[model samples]
Target: MARQTQALARICDVISRHAQEGRAPTALPRVRLERVSALTPPAGETLGPSVSLVVQGTVRTVLCEKTSYYGAGEFVVASVGLPVTCAVTGANKVQPYLAISISLQPAIVSEMLLAAPAPRQTTVSSVAQALATGIADPDLLDVVERLTRLLDRPADAAGLQPLYERELLWRLITGKHGQTVRQIGLPDSHLSQLSHAISWIRTHYDQPFSVEELAARASMSVTSFHRHFRAITQMTPLQYQKHLRLHEARTRLLAHADDVAGVGYAVGYGSPSQFSREYRRMFGAPPRNDAAHLRETSAT
Candidate 1:
């Protein structure tokens, strides 16, 4: 038997070092490495369209009501950009959690699909949510293992990263998770439409919009849009907008810890008291207190 091309153990250590550098990319045009040494409490994060592989340890992420578990040798594919609550479910000093995520650019995926002579047909017909997890195949592991090696070589990464990243996506296109990933590129697909609606909401989060407007934009009936939107995102459109506003408020608060009321108003809060109540509800602390704590944490 031939030796395995991808050594999972070595790959884990490589990403661990990258994460330790304190330079984790929030989104990547190509490939990105992420590592976490200690288990952490669940926190909300907005993720782009991507596929993530667990090289070591474990991670648990909850999107809406759906909770996904990824252990070593497993993969989690976020079919579209989504707001999720995530945390390290398992890790230790001996084996820190290491993961690598690659952004799935729709244009690149479409171009690759067109250039291919025969794209493999996806076997999955069931509707997929924002995130799905599946066991990693050996071929995916091999290609991704090769991709990670480029992180250490700047010259090679510039030239060959695209090729390997394409290969990694190709594997997902043909693998069991192919259907879920394919949905992102299907222009008229339900997931794609929801993505469009999500983009609209995020852009105009400060402004009030109605369900009829969103439904029309997505080319979906009011009932259908409402049902599917909640099903896919685990929240109603209004709820999604609230979270988006709250997330933006939090971001702004990190910079101006003193402007709690201004931050709330800027994020679309008409009532300062309502803002404080909701802020406290979501963040587990009032706006001023939370911002102060965050500032204190950064200083120390």
Candidate 2:
């Protein structure tokens, strides 16, 4: 217990320094260690395929209507593509919220699984669609500490980081989150199938497709595909598409200040009114108003 606490403290120190300087950490894969001094409310949308660890504060993340909370000594794993709203819950100047995010490589995790022997009772089967899981084990924390320490040894990172990364994956697979990790590597599992479907949708979100076609692409019957899609994402295929479309539209408007109709068309909305309605429903405001408000706030 003492060692875990000490390691967490050291992590917090590292993140605090990075946040204070507002500089990205010089590490492989570009790790972002952050320390937020004020509590923040969740808003907007962002893509997260990263693992987030909280060393000194609490955070809540919402994805597709599913909410998850994590705090000091705990971590959250996002296994698949997701749009989420995240915020710090408990932080201040004296005890800032510390976080470290490491992006996941599905290829690496899959490689490790293939090269290693399977653990007992760990079948390569799909369990849940959501990849997010809470982890709070001492062994896992120790591995994370070692991974973080690699930042100090710039010379050794090239050769040793891969080994540490594999160790981290192995720990996750053998830890409480093993079930979800297992599903990601199994090519024929339902989660993997849905993941493939999701990748397709993301690549072609501006185009429309029939449910039958998507189900066929996923290699599942229409009924089964719909059921599993909702079970994992908490939204039907159409609903998921709508979310993706609106989110991307918002990005376009914010990044370029594009006209409402143009942005709508760019993201596949045929009618301006239809796009406005969906945008209002998903973001609680019309596209133009939301974009203007965001710009105004950012400028301030």
Candidate 3:
């Protein structure tokens, strides 16, 4: 535990130097650092395949009815694209929220899986199935530290960063969430199959889709598709579409607060009343009120 603590402190130092107020992109590709000095509002967004390591404060992420809380020394792995609401629940000026994220590449994961040894049987149930969190073991922490340090060496980062990233993925593939990371590389895996339908939903979220249509897209029967979709995403296909719609609507409203009804219609809500109702149900406030609140918060 002492070693882990020291490693976490080192990581915090590195991130604090490089990360600005919001998400700060690093010299390395697909790696970013985040520093937040205050608690953030619950905001909805879609996360692609990636790993998020928290080095300072706690984060609350909600996927449908399931909620996960992970703090310093813990990491969250997202196996596929998921629509989620996330907030930095623990943060302050003294010890702000600090995190490092690396986007996972299926090609690299697939290569590592091919050369990796056969798996051993285990009885570890995933935390949230698709979106799972695990304690970052010593080796994982070491890899993260090494990756963060590379930010200082722009020349070496281009060459050595890939190797370190592979090692980092290896750690995850062998750690508690191995199965979650492993599924991301498997072409025929359930997660990959669901990704196709998920991709479709993301692109055509504003359009109406039937369960059978999504099922056929994923090359599964209606029953199997619905079951796996819910299991992986914690939401039915329809519900997922609704989430994507609401999130997109919120994004639009933030930019054009006065275009509440137009934004709702653009996001596929035909009636302003229905849009306001559903928007209020998902977010705590109605469309216009929520937009005004978000604008006020952003200004300050």
Candidate 4:
């Protein structure tokens, strides 16, 4: 616990020096630091396979119906890409929120799986299931502080970052968050197979298909697929696809469109009325109003 406190202090100091407001990209790929000076409204975004460590303040992320909160000394891991609504809930002008994130790579995790001990579980339940946040232990916290210190010495990081990256991943598997990290690494695990199906759906979202087709793609029966898919994602396959479509449509609306009907069609919504209704449901406004608000925010 002493070491954890010390590490958090060091991490907070480094982040204060290196991270400006909002997300700051680090010298290493897939690593980022975030600083928030004020609480913000809830916003939806997609998070890739990664781990987020909150060194200060707090953030609330809602995935489907479940709301997970992460604060100082806590970390959240996402095994697969997920659409989530998040807000910076506990920051003020006086004390800002600070966080660091490391993107998880499947290839690296796969390699670690061969050497690391398997997660504790029954043979019937060997697959590592979906997990989110875990309180950081002293050892894991210590290694993370060392990893962040690399940002302090940029030249050495070029050669040393790979080593630290591997160590970080290994520790994650053996750490309190091991179960979730393990699921993401094992290529043959149920979560990985579901990830494949989700990937297929995301890439082909504009197209149509039934649950049976997606289930077959994942080599699972429809019932089994639905159960596990919903278990991990907190949404059914159709709901997931709808989110993808709506998110994509919203992105286009915010950035590239003057025609709401065109944006709707392009994102696979066949009917304009249906698109507007769903758009209102998701964004709390009609397409034009939301788009205008987003553009105005971006400009200012």
Query: Best candidate per TM-score, number?
Result: 3
Model 2 Cα lDDT, one tens digit per residue, 185-283:
677768788887888888788999999998988999999999888876777888788878887887788876659999999999999999999888767
Cα lDDT tens digits, model 3, 183-276, are 8899988788888889998999989888888898899999988878887888988889989999999989989899888999899988999999
Model 2 stretches with alpha carbons more than 4 Å out: 19-26, 34-49, 90-96, 114-126, 256-258
Question: CA lDDT of each candidate?
Answer: 0.75, 0.74, 0.88, 0.82
Q: Which should have the higher lDDT, number 3 or number 4?
A: 3
Name the candidate that leads on lDDT: 3
Candidate 3 Cα outliers beyond 4 Å, as residue runs:
122-128
Residue 239's C-alpha lDDT in candidate 2? 78
What are the models' TM-scores?
A: 0.83, 0.85, 0.95, 0.88
Worst 10 residues of 1 by lDDT: 21-30
Candidate 4 least-lDDT 10 residues: 122-131
What's every prediction's RMSD, in angstroms? 3.7, 3.2, 1.8, 2.6
Check candidate 2 and list the clashing pairs.
none
Sort by TM-score, top down from the best:
3, 4, 2, 1
